[model samples]
Target: MKRNALYAGFFAILSLPVFSADRKPNVLLIVADDLGYGELGIQGYNKDIPTPNIDSIASNGTRFTSGYVSGPYCSPTRAALLTGKYQQRFGHEFNPGPPVAGNEPIGLSLAETTIGDRFRKAGYATGWFGKSHLGNTPEYHPLSRGFDEFYGFLGGAHSYVNAGAESNNPVLRGREIVKDPGYLTEAFAREASAFIERKKDEPWFVYLPFNAVHAPLEVTEKYEKRFSSITDTKRRHFAGLLSSLDDAVGSVLGKIRELKLEEDTLVIFIADNGGPTAQTTSSNGPLRGFKSQTYEGGVRVPFAIQWKGKLPAAKVDDRPVIQIDLLPTALAAAGVEAEADWKLDGVNLLPYIRGEKTEAPHDALYWRFGQQLAIRKGDWKLVKGPEANAARGGTAGKASTAGAQLYNLADDIGEVNDLASKNPEKFKELAAQWDAWNAQLVDPKWLPNRRAGARNRNSAENSAAPASKWKSGDSFEDDQAPQIASRAFTISARVDAAAPSGVILSQGGPQQGYSLHVKDGKLALSVRVAKQLSTVVSTEVLPAGSHQVEAGIAPDGGVTLKVDGKTTGEGKLASLIQKQPGEGLHVGNDGDAAVGEYTAPANFSGSVAEASVTLQ
Candidate 1:
């Protein structure tokens, strides 16, 4: 009788509803890509367009003036945010390329545990909506990395209005590709609101990362009309895109307030990095440079967080904080203990933010983008971009590397004044720190085209720096080496039905015994037939001593192969690969592509990128 009574009492205690005070708050991490700080009304933007939605976040919560991302670029900052560590420490310091033949793998190594992964372990529902450029491969996918649900495009950027422009790569719901008819940004907001509503009962962590304001500017008439008075075409288009994004931000906030989950949720709003002033009419204001540099303009962005009644109301923190800090802070707020073995690089910022701790949260923040490097200690910064076009003559067409530049951010936010001469000792010290940190990184498997410099919304003609002005090293760098060195390669091309479609080999050594191949059309019907040949992509293997291999496209369907500049072999064109009817195919690694595609083939060998076409 006594034992039974005790057991009943314990059960009763466990069943009792834990008050809001006892439960962890839901977390909504809203991130914008390439958003400028001054663009928000609260951030001192004088533009007619109102960002009430984005501003409301700061109005209701704490706004951070010195908020910084681990890196100036997208992928590195994302990696740091997810892992709560300097991405350079893990060799994820640059953007991974497109899905077909990406320069690097999809995501952080399995060794790194993401915030979503941590939240899931803490009995919280984890959801990721919007941009997921972390990684495209199965292993690096959000579903595999602690996120219970994912809805977004896997690639870095996508067209907003160009429906079906990218085949089969439509907006995704979980692992399945779902066609989304609404504008992409608006649709993401809808999905995000729906997610919050659906998971209201449980503790949830929702990551809403918008791809708006990044590139390939797409805007709706509703948004466009708001910016009609603006004369500059690109700026007008950019404003329209941002307007849609602002509304999307508004929608999620409205949903939160409507659900009356304000106090129970922790909402954070930030940009992936600083705005591309040249690309978007959006101004970085007083800040200098744009995305892809380590200056304040690139890594420092608008950051605000709100926890309603729990956190102090309407305060500003001048202290610096990086994206990585959110992880441990979220975990701490949830009353979960970070396993000692987990070894997170970020500290719990709540104590410091709440005035409980007086010390600075971090001693330094580091970044590594290929050979480019930066280290921020206090207000001093050491920045460097590798030598410009070392190999090629300093011709206009050759790839040029921008040499090192150092600045005292405290004095020069524009980076206009290079203080390397004035502060040689400080520069040397920071440079040493950067080099030591960079030396630990794994050499790149493949060099990818720099995302910022490539043809995007921010053309040099329109930008603060002209496209022609950017040197080779400043824009392009060798891609990190791949883990699967011997197994991977890529091909890409801007297809024009009227022009001669040729095979272009982008990576790997030679196609001697191993063949670089592609097929057009779906594999629903025929198997052995030639189906449709795509400028028969082939190349001969280079001799072991040869450092480079060459591939040629003949007027005929077959491709001419060469190893070490010598012609190897010619093979008849055939559709060896097959694709399903709806599936599309791509090959090669990262941009600078050369693969061909035919929408309708008798039998489709769905697109095969980095396919293992072994001779056997």
Candidate 2:
């Protein structure tokens, strides 16, 4: 368990002989958030949402037909992917704490060595491109964990357009905030390509994880315009997002090819888990269940590997492969041997890929998150969920064992037909296996982030920033930016209070809009929309004095509202609730009450200033 002393000087010592140039290959692992099995062109998806670049990897190499991540959710799968072992061994069995409050302490244990740390020990220059939700604290940062360069946010998700979304804390470059203007996916790709260009002379391992198809459904006008033929709003946005992600993938592939690194680069593409079809119209096709479940659709995802001229081309493998395999596979490819004493759970897939080994790589794959549990041993899968026994949408009832269901994926991929009763013996065997796996897991290291805090304001303002500046006839349109935050107060402007001279809020995207309304002593704040009804809420009663009010992402991906640091109102958002797109900032209203124009509420407003928004 001792740290490799040579790791500190390896990045600078390019001449070190870790591998002969011909024996070592640079690794570029790309992972998408919440992407489904059938969402890509290689998987027989839409022709309009062409994924020529993503397909390029499959076309030239292997496309895993039954590829799977270790867990259905984001953080757990990432833990397995990075560690080459079951996350339950070290207790990272659920998503980390809320990214905003920095509350999630659950992280990959310091005792466990990461794949990047492995590469660093072998003299590889390591870098991480996007989405580091594995940990948020300084101790768990990529730089501290062997990655020489780190870009992208440290949270599970962020706004695609607004730099303020997630309060901007999650988006960073080597511990510094990077407000790179343009689409987040594209920015990640740009930085990745640049990173490769800069390190062409040395052996490198770049974990390029892209957060393209996740929530906030925000895409650039250019991408959206590409889908002018699609009328359904959700589908159109989803198509745009997929198209952009494809382009980003293509861009990275092209960079490798252009740099002549394709032959030397081992490229892998996978989704963190399955899609939340409700949020992004990502099609899971025939797979049953969405994300946050134990069904096949929740865990099985689109997986492909591209190592030019080395791996077989245009091939399909039906074996179930988990994300955990990547750790050992990459290490094996780099000619660095994994220690036997480490007790790694995954075996190198090179032997199987090379047609040297015929057996399946893993005997059983297991998952545990919150109250959910599942185990896939060969074709048999044992699962228990709140909705387990439902024939369609009906609940399986509250009885834990009565609610449990079993499916033979070899026979039914959709999981429509449960075989628990018909094949009681097989179900019992797999259920026993699942129990043994669950018994090994420690309790969830941290509960989901559900703290009460001011939403729509900079973290700096959360403590001490500028005072609120509200004015009549002022526009708060900019308050709707995905990243910009507006703080609400319970106390009225006091009528006698002086009005601020200028607008305190700075709105960005054109569609970003907001409003402050007062009716019968109740102050209502709302997100103004162009054609649709605005989302409004009544602030808690003002206590005859100044009081703060705010709402933003809850720890569990829900929306929470707070008045003076106390919970006031909360609502769950459909996955599509993203900030409006725009450029101009409106303080109170746009001065015009026409459609799409901000209308100033007649209520006398107070002074507002130092209003800001940020992404965490």
Candidate 3:
């Protein structure tokens, strides 16, 4: 391999001892988006995609077989990872929808400190390269959130190919959009490596979160050719994406080795959340459920760490661990003690990994994502949520949980067995503990990005007819809201779309109900049932005159949206809303929880003549 002039000045730092207290360790936090637990070769579940570089981090140091992320979705997990606290503690319980049911900023709460802040305060060169799902607004950019430099998109997921200013989510170099950011994953790898090389003289913390193997599964021609063996189109694309990620990891690791800084770096690898199998052909192995659910497959992910000479080699630590622990561990590696008032959910794992502690880092790990939640105390676990609620929503209603399932993770890692009946006491015990934990949490800072994450605090589940008709914008309480639990329903409205855009009528706030609105002058119906969103938008812009629009749902969950008796758009939901939406109807003007993309108090600029709902 040929070495360039930029690599010529790295000879002095080569001989630093692995366990030396003479210098602080640099941190490399690499996060993969929606990666399946079974995809990594070290997990021994997938034989298709080989992730040698990532697996080496496990082979060389510690791999937590029971590793879990705080949330089953992208933003929540990242928020916890950076802040070192449960996101729910600060009301960041769901992905930033429009405005939440309550008033809160659209990104991570500024009141809380982040890992980047901690490391930057410690005099380290901090940089974030890759997905910055924290917030898209200026206040939430990586630069504002503590990183000195940021090179990536600010949204949850971005286009891997057309990642320019023209894309909905464009690549950014600091605050400016990069006109041409070739192949985002590769760009991230390059940006991370470049940061290291540029800041080789000082301690640096790099948060590299690659949005690979996510949707819009496009792979470079080179990587596609590399994965030509796979017959399945989706699987082959997945393999290629996974391979690119692996190679990118290898390249960055190689950079460190080339600079002889491997011994001085504390490296951590984790999937942001489990893969969405249906969308990307990702495999969670035998674990039940996929992304956005509270299962081992959704929250439990492939986690590994490496510090070269300081940690054990090829060790599998089965103790339960979560992503929240990364901050304290990285800080400890840097010789900084975590302050007590920080109140972080994650613990310093280096002590436990170094054999200084015999017990697990945490005694109990808890999670709350609207309609679904879970708690794990040792081998016993209690969890419940709809399966694969892809559109992560947050409820404005009471936290209702009536069907909590219990499982012994040691015996049933797949979560196929229901031990709740056989272990009533155990279930009740975990439930009480969870209730206590849930009580300490606050309402969401904002709603879910999709109309989802509506968690009911009470243990009540009832089936009833929802408010079938409404003409006013009065907010119905969750309990009093229309109860459309797994039933077919229809929403119809006659409104003027003369104005630009606004919500004309909405039954459920988000993630679990339907919203009829105008966006960018186009009429659209957003139907969310069972936490999955199926949006149908009209092809043409709305005319000035009053238009009659109706959203019809079939008994089998099929949905169609019509404008003035013309079928403008159509979609199909997997199922009806499994539970009544907490944020009730806000017909005419979404005064409560936002129903669509518009902000709360989403008053229609155009007049709404009549609005109603029909349940079948």
Candidate 4:
């Protein structure tokens, strides 16, 4: 079917009233971070793990058997869920890094209207509780982005047990940093319950995104005792963490029951993305791959929706439904008409849920994560790059040499069988469709540093320079340079500053790299790995003359910066750059991408006399 026709049909179906015009049901959107598809007992993929509260959501509502998230990671899926559109369309295609000095604008674009905005316009109280990884800037805060009340950490991950003032990730009540309550999960549940209680008299939208089950596997005894029967250490810890999440769900549900608001509330339970099974010991069950890949185990998450008396209960929805659908679904439930200008990619699932439409809600679902690309139409799935093999925890063979693999999910849910050779016609069709769809998407706003074990060739050790004099825009080719390795190294340059600020020496891209640059007349050194940036800038500025600037990386990852012979700044990184940059080093500029927030190729306005790299 044509894309336009499919969308038109959806609009036509959604035009039918799903609820009474006089009453708009309160929306409770609960999203679990890195929740495995097999974690919930309702799925029957794992028998040992008991999730009675989470399972009750499906038992009392409709369980989606093939529920998928738009992205294979957290932030991207949240972006899609918020806008009811594919994140790629708005350039929110990757997880954004925390704000740095130069790179402060990383966040969801303000162009798109969010679900909170829509619901608020339709007369609803909007509250966001838990994780808000969309953005860290003041403008990107949940309160500014349509939510009236916000309480959560702005970054991706946080410690569940201890979120103290000194913690990297701290909990916030609105804009103020508050003391960490007893435990993070329970605190979030308490906040969610309060929001519901505060807005029970009127229509409200509560976006509860729990950071539980993500990482830092810390669990209190309250939940740890429930999973002591599991002998595996990591699995046992994961179970405990999951139990806390279940209790959180139960807390919110219990409140709804107590307030007698069950009939007037629309509750949705889903995972932001699939679990990182290897790291967290969270099982994807029969599915292959984990988070950060295009496989079913990465994107296909546990999803269910419940609305007492309004929708059927104990029904299994075998058709595929995506997180994007929630926006339009909620809007329809609230009796609000969605405008065509929104250009949402999701459909209202009311007709399908009501049994008014027998056809599937979507004709195709697409995913693009860095170099990996996948397209699923009906039961046939075509994947390019390492995702096909990465799901199996193996190195991905070259797609150009091996071609894209085709799999029929109906027969092989784990994606073990390759049907590319047997089904050439289907493979060709899916590939062509994927290409056409990809053509419409803009280049990613920011590309991740790593792609399924592949490192940037330009930043390899061989690409290093022994000694080179560089002009404004000149950059060295990627060679096997010993200094580029993650070890003790020193970079020193003798330069005459013609301009106040510019890059003196740099390697790598936005995701991971090291750069020594002059910013606002101050010498600054920045090292980035896995999107985390740490920098040390000199307290004093360079006085418009020839001077020697040097940066040293200790074996322990401690960084030291010196101007002439004196120490200017010092800091430490827990880890060094792992992936090489696609663009090699620059002596007088940053090359194609900036290591931090500075603009790309921040060309130097000075001349370099001599530059040398020494490795210990």
Candidate 5:
């Protein structure tokens, strides 16, 4: 009888909600898109971009110095955060490419249970607002994936100001399109505050994944005016975006306080991934590498959690924690015990936050992004990725380099010192642990154009960089390329040819596509639609020192070719290709299935560049 009483009492204590005795607490999870490690005022380095509302989460509760996301990108981190497991466990390793008609594999696997699903099952009203990159297909929509209320773009990104009909990814309100969504961040704030206000009597979960601070940076004058002092154009723009995000956060926070739900709401804030410093001027201060790489700057991000009157305020926890923990922790706070069969990779952090547990929330955190892989155990990390891209010798950009380097992050936060040769034992141990984790994960549901693991909104442009920037023998997946149908576009190139007889640029295949090449010692343009071919060769022939080639496609099905500012050839087709070219864009060679009347690997012999011409 004594033993039975003790067991029952322990279970009761563990299962009790961590809020007032009336009802379960509401959960407000705010995720920022492509934010950097050192971009916030609270992060100590960035004084320019003040984020008081975001910083308040830390001032009110706890701040994690070594906070991280599971993957270095958007969708993969989101997958892990929602499922409470490593995204790779179920093969959600990369961002699913642009939504195509029959491409059904491009989404989060239906097998995995989501946090929204769990909350709904537990009788909580659940809502998701902002970017849903999981998949854009009907079956993969948030409504189908357990979210009761979804008001965001299905693709990785959407224009913040343009809620127009022509966009590839449109703003959605439930199943209907939102044609007139005023400024996205503020719109999200209003919707979220309204949801919380109406659902005050019931348990609720609100996911506000703001797509700010990414690319195509644009904001209203109200936010931009606040940063008029900063002069650098890009930096000034970035400041405005950051300010806008902070204000949006403040609006939501204010609502909770106004409703007297401060103590009964669990507020968590984290960035989807680190900054893409090259694309946007976002900084990952005191950290090396950018968004696409496996360095600290790519994976580490600002993280804070607050539940007033529950977790201690004004605390800083240096122990490493990850986005995956949010799911299990939220579940725990709701007084729901995680099932044994869930196989969750995240730990319930309530105990640790309350000082009931002293150790780290995670003994080890692992990541596998395509060719890149990392495992951080304690202060030591074993990583193999493109950190070599930072000008180190023999250390190539390939992650599967037979062996990964070791680093004690306690001393070398920048990862400059490769201690693998010195501490062979530690390196081997971590390598082995990463291998074990890798073996458990399945193959990805879908693959990107390249294994670059791009996490941005303009991945086709960003991931295709360095490889397709006027380089020979490089191909790029050009999704919804502007050349198709009635959409008019121009393809221009500058080349220095050794011998003027090769393919310059080509996309698609024999069935439907376009190509520009030097044919019969003269510039030629070809357009193939439904196997009906239209080839036009230049009237003038012969040599070249430096030449400019341009191919223009008119919406009225007129094609024109120009060489060195001279009209070479002109042709009228029945119609241009209607849909997206199935094949990818080839820089200097026709990859495999050629669109032109040339053999395979019609490689350009000379250099193609924006500026390779020199006048002696």
Candidate 6:
């Protein structure tokens, strides 16, 4: 905790006998998915969750107190992180939900060059492991984006335990669907460590983005037992998931230390976006809003940079720095200068951090998420749209301020008081500045499939309806679905199998939902809450004729799949699908979004004689 002394010691350690390296330093970028600012023990937000390995990055390096991502969601931040430019500039906005038939080029535009491309061009070995939510197509694959080696899924999220053929998003090894390799976070770490060991003698750039602590809240007993004291089941499981991610970070860092690559490597740890606190019980501390909104909790994330003997250690930098800065910072560390034609939005931080430059790295930071937009100049911030009232837990559709809401972030990190009315000039200046920046960006290449129907004003009031019925191809709006306080529910369907595989009934989108479907002749029931999925597959395939298939969820989160009154499969879910699906229920198809990994609208080919959804 002795700040100056620790920093001096770190510099002193650089002069050791192992410090002979005329070669460019290797770059290691680690990104956690939906990680909250309050999760880290070092952050003093959550004392129960221990993240020693992650905290080590802060202890041995400089932690940015006000670090942020360009976007409030997954894909957009990734696009910006890789391109070093605002993703809105290239129309790479919104999560490209399960592939649509004609939306072939729905990913990071090829016109933009990635940081991996720059490192590879400099003759460095580049590998990308874990989530690549940018695009699912071959052209948008990591290999096409400058990474020489790729191992992970192309979509947004995947199952941590079972990432095989049955999974909606299968784990891939350089484009080939491979068998599930134990837990996903561990597998990513193993692959990253192997890459480091193999390329120890060469300069390498490894991008390890672990989709941990996201959703579906699935954790093995190995991790689950660690948080037994946490009585809240949802938060307990989240802690376990976070612990596993921490271990994975330790694994990679262990390899670096074991191989003596720490001094010659620049390791950066950050999250793609803020945690979705409502669904997964992810605590963002006092920050406002969750993912998808332009609030501090949605865009602000834990960020740290470490270069063993190079950068000052155990220091906390409060200056505002964005994830886009990583690209130029890494390039600068790797002895590569980006060309002016690239038009990078990030600035290199080496000079500024080293005391060679005194001015702040960036004069202002900006954000744009759909109708929401915000801009920060020094300590003053101006936010428009729903973000202004998001911290108060208000719905996005609530009355807007018309022009903008202003706040002094330095004085009010929680974004409580709005100073717009009191200081009209500052608010107007920032709002106009945001407008000018917005004018330069292109329209979104594709928009997300927003939830239809009016918001249910009385979601708390349960209707007296006992059951709802549906037939083949019949769909219901989100409001039409039975609203229950508890997560317990039962769904039954009588179907005549006329095709090999298709969805019989489903609710929610890729982020969360549940579906009873047929895949390769087997009846499968998958309940998805966020990124975690609990699927129960029938032991026996359905007959060529009519059959009764039922899926039920108990209050305790136990799932059961029954075929003709006989239980065929069973599983458990740590958390319920609390996030309302954007698209509503579909009897014969999954609608615009998929409940699990299966493609959207995997419409049932046969007739659904009777489908009933009952709240337990």
Off by over 4 Å in 5: 1-20, 98-104, 387-401, 450-616
| 189-272 per-residue lDDT for model 4 (tens digits) | 999999988777788899999988887577898777888788887788788889899999999999989777888899999999
Estimate the TM-score for candidate 2: 0.72
Alpha-carbon runs more than 4 Å astray in model 3: 1-21, 101-103, 165-168, 387-396, 450-616
Give lDDT per model, in order. 0.61, 0.66, 0.78, 0.78, 0.77, 0.79
Q: How accurate is candidate 2 locally (lDDT)?
A: 0.66
In Å, residue 490's CA in model 2 sits off its true spot by: 11
lDDT of 3 by residue, 66-130 (tens): 99999988999999999999999998887766455545567898898999999999989999999
Best by TM-score: 6
Q: What is the Cα-based TM-score of model 4?
A: 0.72
10 residues in a row with least lDDT, candidate 6: 392-401
Model 1 scores a TM of 0.69
| lDDT tens readout by residue for model 1, 1-616 | 9999999999987764344546678999999988876788888854666788888888888898888887776777888888887776665656663222344454676778899888999999999998887776688878999999988887666667653444434568888877654798888899889988888778999999998877656778888788899887777887888889889999998998887788888888889888867545567778876676656777889999888887876788877788888888888888876677877778888887688987778777776654455677777777753332222211112211135677777678677788878877887777777666666666432233333322321233322111222111121232211111222222122221121111212222111111232322100011122234233323322222212233333223244544334455454434233221111121322121112232111111112222221111
lDDT tens per residue, model 5, 259-321: 778999999999999997754678999988777567899999999999999999999998999
Residue-level error in angstroms, candidate 5, position 400: 3.7
TM-score of each prediction:
0.69, 0.72, 0.74, 0.72, 0.72, 0.75
State the lDDT at 185 in candidate 4. 88
The lDDT of model 5 is 0.77
Residue 428 lDDT in model 5?
A: 80
Off by over 4 Å in 1: 1-21, 98-105, 385-403, 449-616
- Residue 147, model 4: lDDT of 96
